[model samples]
Target chain A: MHYIEVQKKDFNVGYEYQQLVKDNSSDGAVVFFVGRMREFNQGQKVSALTLEHYPGMTEKLLAKIEAEAQERWPLEDSLIIHRYGRMEPGEQIVLVVTASAHRKAAFEACEFLIDWLKTKAPFWKSEETAEGTKWVEAKASDDQAADKWSEK
Target chain B: MITVLFFASLKEQLGCNGISLSGAGINTINDIKQSLIADKPDWSKWLHKPNLLCAKNCEVVNGDCSVTSGDEVAFFPPVTGG
Candidate 1:
């Protein structure tokens, strides 16, 4: 099974995990990653974050990324859920889960999914701070992380 | 007509969400951008950003990619999602 979602509301991680593992006994390893809104960034205290995305393109690119992951790994299942709109600090922002028969495949695939999502998915973030609302800049570190995968 | 859309800071900077332009004499994504810049010279600053991204009909494409009537084109900055 492969699931991808772009939603405005919060998701229940436990429920999503159960959905990924239910009746799937073949996979011995499961890896999941959760990304959260941070309270501070760039030496400033962030009070809120507003996520924006290209409605039609966001879903298309996410599904493409998930498909690419499946092709590269011997995977049993995977799930990706990302949220948008205004969210406070500590709120859940994204989830990625991968299940495979071996720990290596599960772990690597989960990391690859996130790396690609960070740079390829068309979601932008605007953070609210003490001074004013500011758009979050894309980090060079993120580009480097994603680039490493293509080198392999 | 072709529909052009902008997002994120580019949208805020351009001060417009989307607009429709005549497909006549426009051959590629670059043409669409040039036309936009021509109409609102002030938009050149945002639209011409070095890392600006473009998409056609929901797929990423280069400025030289061919476009025609009824296609949805998008312009935005580099992605910051995770």
Candidate 2:
């Protein structure tokens, strides 16, 4: 199953997360990754960040990745939440959770979901700094993380 | 005619997200993209870069692929974040 939201309100992702795992009673393991907005990027002090997405295409892309993870790793349930508009420092930007029959499938699939999402989903991050605003570019590490899975 | 769409940085640089162009000989998505870039040299940054990809008819499309009239051709940067 799939759950997705892109909004400005603060989210109780924990409850929604538990619901995903609970809905699939057979699931034995649940794994999640929360992306937080940090205060710094490339030596620049960021007070806030704005995330923008291509609405329909963004949802479509994420759903596709979630489906791929399920097919590759036997995940029973999955939830993905991504926030848009302006977000302050330390705010939660995104969450990826997966539940499966075994710990390995849950963990690997959850990791794979986030990894692929980083490179394949159509969301852009821009920094709001005292100096000015600038869109964030993809990091080499992020590409490496996603590439490793495709290679395997 | 073909509707050529842009997104994010591509839109920012082009100052517009979309345009409708004459598509007489443009039987392929790549042809439409080439026509747009050829008309607006300023968009060279986006068209020539390897980071940019084309979406034909709402799906990621290869550069060599063809498209019929009225197809929507979207150009996007390499995706980042979930």
- Output the number of the TM-score-best candidate: 1
Q: Quote model 1's iRMS.
A: 0.6
Q: Given candidate 1, what's the lDDT at residue A125? A: 97
Interface DockQ per candidate:
0.91, 0.68
The predictions' CA RMSDs to the true structure, in order, are 0.8, 1.9
Q: What is the lDDT of residue B17 in candidate 2?
A: 79
Write the residue-wise lDDT of candidate 1 on A93-146 in tens digits. Answer: 999999999999999999999999999999999999989999999999999988
Write model 2 residue lDDT over A16-127, tens digit each, in one string: 8667755467878888888898898889899998887776777788888887887788877888888788889889888888888889998998888888889888888878
Question: Which candidate wins on lDDT?
Answer: 1
Least well predicted 10-residue stretch by lDDT in candidate 1 chain A: A16-25
Candidate 1 DockQ category? Answer: high
Question: Per-residue lDDT for B8-76 in model 1, tens only?
Answer: 999999889999999888999999989988888998888888899999999999989999999999999
Off by over 4 Å in 2: A21-24
Question: Residue A57 in candidate 2 has what lDDT?
Answer: 76
